[model samples]
Target: MAISDIKRYTHLTDTDVEALSAELAGIRRAVTTSLGAADAAYIRRTIAFQRLLDVAARLTIYSTRSLAGQLLGATALGVAKSVENMEIGHNISHGQWDWMNDPEIHSRNWEWDMAGPSSQWRYSHNYRHHVFSNVVGMDEDLGYGVLRVTRDQPWRPEHLLQPVRNLLLAATFEWGIALHDLHAEQDRTGTTAEKSALSRALIRKLARQVSKDYLLFPALSGRRWRRTLTANLTANLLRNLWAYVVIFCGHFPDGAEKFTRAELENETPAEWYLRQMLGAANFRAGPVMAFLSGNLCYQIEHHLFPDLPSNRYARISTQIQALCEKYNLPYTTGSLARQYLLTLRTIHKLALPDRFLRATSNDAPETASEQKVRAIHETRGTDGRTPRRRHRTRKAKRQVPHGV
Candidate 1:
């Protein structure tokens, strides 16, 4: 289908859009009220669990002789804890758990404790990503440069090996990618010179710490340095592999949408929302997968309602899909394995220079079949807005606290 046709295909009827919006608002209110009532118990449990994990991690590190074994144990524990941080703890800290909590505590937990330094994730994933998602320059999920997580970027010469490069980047720079927003924020806020100075200082400090802890400490404590290094490397590789596989399965599939800044700028809010729906992919949903990957499989729902705790996504997805169907909107979803294979195929296709090297030619003008689908939803627009189910007042949107 042509890009314009695809855009038109996802338009929702006024009634359906209003219904979905109301459903979303109801969920937000219900979750917030429940969380408020359960906040104290939730906080206590989170604190206790974190403390136990912290102590256990430290003990595991100190007690093992085989550095490889110790590293493996530590990595396993870290991955588990990180999942909790990303999913449950991060949501709690974001006030997704309880809108009634003190903002200061929520902000602190979000920044320093649970989600780490990826403030971009907050802006990109929570704010811009969910708000203006799938639009080029809006969703931070698109790789910053060279890497093509999204089809939006014009392909470069180096992108010919994108599949290999993506895998390598994921394995080697997964942690770096997680922290990229920190650097982006620094660039946005600080002068170039100031950012450079701070960067140098931070790098020096980190290097010194790594040298002292990873190199000197082992030697001085009479631990086997070589074994320690090997263990750490092996553990990191395994952990990163798991993380990459889980993350990559969400997006980067064939039939995904890509847009330039001009395209995004010209689109309406409803259009942009549809782009996100069509561009983003969802994985299989289940308790085990949710626990392991932090419920990211419900990526579309998460992008739609970032403030609602992720645990509620699976339950609401059916209603969301029904609303989409009623509205003729595209709700892109599939099994985890199926989506993963699709992503791989996309990567393989993107790896070739010819596929994307030229300015993406219009996909052989849209067929009659595509026009039929587009014609169905093309008549709907905002003229049908009603007082009872209009866009939330600007004040309501702004009432969400600053950190949130």
Candidate 2:
């Protein structure tokens, strides 16, 4: 799995990898040093706007008497909830604004509106998922230990229902994440009492979340409780579905490569940086879409510097793209719709066992290893040399990849 004896599975050599790593580190340093009042003001204003929107939306839902007015209020509330969940809560929990030294904005103190506790999610997400990135067996976030995202992960008989499970996962993404994190917590080395404590924490968080949305708000509506209850349910589901789309587009797209445990052996910062660059994909977005997705359309940049302010990702992406071009690497990105379609393709394709797939585990779009480059070279000639490309006519057939 060695690429020019560097073991990074990339086109770059050891020296080139080191240089790439240094440039990335420099970008981080530049962004870190420039964190100023603008960054602080951005986060503060975001939080205030989200809270105000939430309150206004809730009031509209309660007071609106007409059906059209009810739908409008619920939709607005969903937008507000999505903004809070994606931009404010998600970034704050990443410790992105920790540099400001504001306790309210601190990662550890900011609990999200989801059913899962922020403390529990931090362990599974910031530590396990971010640190491991796309390393097959280690990064549980790779398909969240359920769907088969890569050929490297062998398919099972149960994966036949993956298409169905995919829908369910999207519709209930928040609940899935909550249970996923809880399961991750229990799987660790903990005594029975300790396990019970973790479960209780999740139960308490879930109770509070459920009550606030379903009970308290509806009860306040008196005879109109059913209408309020349905509105809250609709809003929560909308947020869940949107979060699912943003998340899946980032990790499971065709060009976002998956790695094996072998690659993590004696890993260096340079190699780690390379892994993240190759492992995460991005979707094209304007300012509005970026805000709606919590600026996660720059997921490659976020993965590169998880602790950096999320608002800075747009600028960081430009520098990252330049480095990718200089290093002759893939800056994997596309329109949001295209990226999601690619993700869905991978999901449905990998539902079958590997034998049914056309590509090897090492050379597929969603999976690759260092040997991948060598395999391409050897295919062209026995001397490990590549041949010239032959142009095809307009009438020539196109070769479709597996599960196209």
Candidate 3:
């Protein structure tokens, strides 16, 4: 079939497009109304209590380990608390608890209590990951010196030892990897230096407090120092390992795209969105796993509509898939276990010689006529009442998915 014919057949009609737009608007309205009706003070209090519970849980695991009797029980409790941090704590901190409340306040609170001062999962995962998406240079999830998960950029010498580095990072400093991108941002943006002197002083004080907890609290618990150290170490290790594995399983699968800025800049919004969907894999959908991962399994939906609450990801994904199909775009997804295996397979592929990593024709752009249709679809309506398009501009003939 001719490219123009394919384009006409695939692109959504204005009515279909309007329907998708209305669905998204309805979701926003529902979330806004729910937030407006919620008791903000109650949410704030509950979030505070949850933070305290998390701290208590962590301390309990440490103390239980020092006492050395219920190893399995302690581990289970620690895992449960970690899951809470991922779900409830993370959600509230994201201001997903009440949409009406100021996100900045909740973000600050989240950074303080739930995520720890060092954790940047909010900015890296929530902000940057969704905004920039599968684009390599922009997506902080790609690689952070420790894990060579995606092959978006040219291979570096350090990447040669990615397997070893990733394992060591998971074992020793998983939290550190989470914060690396945030630290890089602070350094690049000079925000770290712009902090008030008093704030800096307070941060030093907090660092000291955390250090004391790490160094002295375990020994002071009246248990054997060795036992206390071992327990604390094990708890930290397990927590980091779980975090690393879960995140890695989400996007580093085989067949996932690792697009460069050059490649992305040449594509239209529909094409970029399509690439993101195909490049990002979903985990298996289950209540427990969804709850634990904060509903990240619907990653494609999450990427396309980040403002929407996580609870509605699965429901919205169907709509997103329909839109993709209408545009003749790929909508990639898979079970959690399948995606995890794919990640291992991707790693193996990366292990191949650099010469074998060359791009194939499958990665290239579509015909000129296909490009023209994408351009027409992406053009803003001149009705002069709609929001002006603010996303990336297109340059090549490629399939891009529309926002729904």
Candidate 4:
């Protein structure tokens, strides 16, 4: 379980690992001590803003049939729901603000504006996904039971249309996520028993979500029920698409690594951290966009310290990058636009079984950086903008020399 046992850390000595552990401990202590009035106020203010947006959106939709009203209402609702699902709910459920000990804001008590139940999500997402990460067989997030994300995952005929499947999944991401918790694939493959009770729990959770959005609220509008229903659907669709994009970009960009079960055997905490670093990607974004995405743009930091207050992710990103550099680790990051495109391209490429067919391809294939550059050249060079040679020179300048 020692860090040295991991192939990626072969260059590091035990003393080098001790240095990393100490550095990480220092970061945690500093951030933990800094958590107090500012952190609490930030979350409280965010909640209030989200509530204001939700109420305004709903009232506007109920009172007016105008196109402007509907647009405003839908946009506002989508933003509010995005904040709830990402910034508020996801972070809280990671126990980020649990240190405050406020009953309402506590992770255990906070239910999000998604189809999945908070408790179930905490188990599947906070515990399982965080622990297993991109371990091919173990990480449910690898394909979310729909498309082929890694070459190690056997491609099926269904995956031949993954580009279409990926789009549909994004549009209905909330429901997709809710169903993901069911582990239907496990049951189908006979790898595990069907947990009928968990399935029932998921169904009940879906029912509650449907009731709130499609049934209860629309009914409250009486004559305006149609408008309200349409608005709710629009809001949910927007939120789902946004979450899908952000989550996918963070975990499946070209540079993000995947692992086999053998690679994960006897993983120590340091090795676990290393796996997270390899498997996660970050994107460059500003405060507004970051907050909407739950600051998951700083995904490398979030994975390294899941329970850290998300607002602090941006603040500590520089330090984290420095630590990664010191340890000679890849701190994968890019513009949001670039990273998202990379993810989409990856989805399309893996749809074919070509990678699986080339047997030695797994051992000695294109490095992530090469794949990323090739993707960009193929996808973006049509505009006749930056010349290939100039782009290569720029990329070379950006890359840190190995063993630095």
Per-candidate clashes come to 0, 0, 5, 0
lDDT of 2 by residue, 1-404 (tens): 11222333454578888899999989999999999999999999999998898889888988889999889888888888899898988899999999898998999799999989988888889888999888878889988877989776767999998999999999999999999998878878469998899999999999999999999999999998998899999999899999999999989887677777777888899998988887788888999899999999999999999889888899888888777656656677888888899899889998988888887776676665556655654564444321211211110111111111
Which ranges in model 4 have alpha carbons more than 4 Å from their true place? 1-10, 184-194, 355-404
Residue pair clashes in candidate 4: none
Off by over 4 Å in 2: 1-8, 380-404
Q: How does candidate 1 score on lDDT?
A: 0.53
Give the per-residue lDDT digits (tens) of candidate 3, residues 170-219. 67444454346445445445454653433454456456645654577566
Q: In model 4, what lDDT does residue 121 have?
A: 78
Per-model TM-score, in order, reads 0.71, 0.92, 0.68, 0.85
Tell me which residue pairs clash in candidate 2: none
Task: Give lDDT tens digits, candidate 1, residues 1-404.
Answer: 22343333333455554565666567657755665445555454655675676556545655676756577556755564555555655565455654546554363444432212434445434554556455566566665444655443556778777777777866755445545545555546548786676456445544664575367635643555655454445545655666566666655544345445554555655454455555555676678677556677776676666667666677767766666544534455567776677667656665555454443333211011234333322433335643123222121011101101
Clashes of 1: 0
- For residues 63-101, what per-residue lDDT tens digits would candidate 4 score against the true structure? 877899898998899999999999999999999999999
Error in Å for residue 1 of model 2: 10
Give the C-alpha miss distance for residue 186 in model 2, angstroms.
Answer: 2.0
The ten-residue window of minimal lDDT in model 3 covers 390-399
lDDT of 1 at 274: 52
Error of 3 at 373 (Å): 16
